[model samples]
Target chain A: MPTIRVSANGEAALETRDVRVRYGNNEAIKGITMEIPRKRVVALIGPSGCGKSTLLRCFNRMNDLVPSAAVTGEVLFHGENLYADHVDPVEVRRRIGMVFQKPNPFPKSIYDNVAFGPRLYGRPPDLDDIVERSLRQAALWDEVKDRMNDNALGLSGGQQQRLCIARALAVTPEILLMDEPASALDPIASAKIEELIQQLVEHYTIVIVTHNMQQAARVSHYTAYLYIGELIEYDDTNTIFTAPHEKHTEDYVTGRFG
Target chain B: MSPADSARASRHFDQELQELRELLLRMASRAEEQVRNALAAVKQRDAQAAQRSIDRDGEIDALELEIEERTINLLARRQPMAGDLRTLVMTLKISTDIERVGDHAVNIAQCAKRLAEALPVPDVGDLDRMAEVSTGMLRDAIAAFIDRDAELARDVCQRDDQVDRYNDSVFRGMLSEMTRYPGAIVAALQMMLVARNLERIADLATNLGEDVIYIVEARTVKHHAGEVVSDVETEGEFDQ
Candidate 1:
């Protein structure tokens, strides 16, 4: 895990303290102590099987769905330990939403997909306002506002991904964990998602996992490089890309290793 | 990247980077050759050689454009990071410097053509010394870039003062000669311009040396020359 450095005037939104995850006998995340500053994008980048995704899943307890996965150590959300045996995993996920690699929007109508999260938790009196606000925040309202009743699966791959992001926003999440959110899209669509991420950081803290080092360099303020289940280096995105301190991080960023 | 670790996982990327380096070095050598030809024309009063040096500036300009195209293509396709990125950026900048060096050489060669036509050309020994120092700096700067030697680059930076002193002495001597031999004032003024061009070349060479230090150590020693104690002190400050 990388060291945590708070923003100039704000505290960390999420802090992981020596967090480790083990799948049966294989230790996926060796030990990480990273901080996600409020309203900033922190990207986790590494080669395949480097445990960047496993460490990302620890944020909202997504790994709990796997029976073989066992997590130890503290994940703090706004100073509250998330794994203290009393917090509801559902509530944790509601506050810290996720977007997967593939755009897995529901087969329901486009409007219904954005409303799913809010309705599942509790119907608010301003449900229509919530859906509109979420769609607009995701930058997809103008494209899909007229097709509210159309099936979400009918949208393009990029639109489906934005709908997933709108769904995550519908719950009013404080943090968004995205795993390869634009890997399945073309260059244009990937650029749109990256732009939306830049806009979303104003309202939400984001932790993204990506194999695209350039994307991480373009979108994130802080970057953490993981290698073989270990945190190799973490620093400002500019520093990581231009002059990384660790030799391993430098080698990886410069494409010097296989 | 270290010497052994400079090779990338992709051999194509390595080949492209090597090609860029070779192109830059070729431009540097051509610029150096132009300076030599220009100075030789002045020393021998040969108008044809000076005209040849002036005409050859177009080749250096074309090479600059080619280097720029290759650098842009590499940036778009490879998205080079860290040292590779630095190398591409520095290549773009150094190519421009070399092209400008070629221009200065042309300016000296133009002055040489005028001096060859004028009457009673003054002694060009001071001008020769200035050319010798400036061209040596240019050669050493390019050598420092090829070897990735920060120490040698710093040494190049320190030698800029000597070239400046040579330029001042040449200017003062030319002014005294113009006062004594008012009939040959045109040639004296042209020789002064040649010295000025050589001085500018030295300055550009120092700029190239600073760029080399930036590439090798990733620390800028350009304007902060007074603060840098030694090259060793600049090594571990990569975070800056």
Candidate 2:
């Protein structure tokens, strides 16, 4: 295994050293080393089952919930090894939050949903202020500020996703991991999410996994191309979209491959 | 094939790209021929041949419009990236350049027709050489574009200085002829106009060359010629 090149500048908020993930007999992620820059959006893109999602999961110890799954190698957060003994996985997840492929908002009111994480974890003082600030950070405050008591499920698909983002923000994470955040929404809604991602990146480091290369090009500052569980290429978004070094990456981005 | 490659390759978009390339090549070939014939018309002082160049300008204009429409259609619909995106954008820009090249040919033809109608001046041999070099530059630039040859495009850019030198020589020669022979003044000025048009043609060809370099190498060598340094090119770490 070799050190994967991360060409972009700035200190890496999250770093992976030869990280590999395996589920039972199947090796899903090969040894991959990456330096994800702080306060920047890095998008992981590849074809289905290429380990983009698996690698993204490793950033926050999301793979720990799976049985028979083993992740070797170190995932470091700002120079601290996350896999060290006594480092709680729950705390790791709380610090590094995730938004899934679909908008999985709770059945409760929008305000309650944003407050849920805080109440369960630290029960931060001034719960109302926290909820308001989270909603504002997620760009959902103006739309649902009056309807804070409304059920989150009653909101539009795009709004529900934003509410989910607000919920994720309620915990006040340092880094945000989004897996196909806008894949389930309409083009207009997807554009909104993309805009939100751009703004939120100023406050938190973001790592997104996306199948849409154009969206990756649009929203991310950096892009990583993965193929068959192996890290193929990682570079700035402009380079990956315009002139990728790897033949596999070129083929994938140009629609020469699936 | 890899499993993903075997899945679905979007063959329709690939075919569209192929068709667009061919159409742009055809347009370039037509423009190139018009340039050659128009320069020949100037050397021969043949109004009939000059008229042919004038007649074809509308066709080139229509072709330009068609290429623009198709390019916009592909960009809006396919949402291309990487090499495909560069190709389509350069096609749109190169077509505009070629169409303007066509217009320059027409301007040369107009001068040729006026020179044919006026009293004759001594032929300036350098204008013929300048015509040959500029037309050849146009041909090679289009060739580099269609073939995706960045080096060939750079060669075209390097030749622009030569055309500029010939233009300077042609201007001095025509000015001397105008000063010497009072009766040949009108024809000398027409010849000068023809030389000016040829020089502009060379500049457009240089534009085509710079665009081809972008299409082929993903490099912007527009104002600065030779080696273009970008973030991707300078970052040695990502070379692996």
Worst 10 residues of 2 chain B by lDDT: B230-239
Writing each residue's lDDT as its tens digit, candidate 1 over A42-92 gives 999988899999999999999999999999999999789888899999999
DockQ of each model vs. true complex:
0.40, 0.50
Off by over 4 Å in 2: A1-10, A147-150, B1-9, B226-240
Candidate 1 residue runs with Cα over 4 Å from true position: A1-10, B1-9, B117-126, B228-240
Q: Give TM-scores for every candidate, taking all chains together and pairing residue i with residue i.
A: 0.90, 0.92
- The lDDT of model 2 is 0.87
What interface-residue Cα RMSD does candidate 1 give after superposition? 5.0
Report lDDT (Cα) of residue A223, candidate 1.
93
Q: On a 0 to 100 scale, what is the lDDT of residue B137 in model 1? A: 90
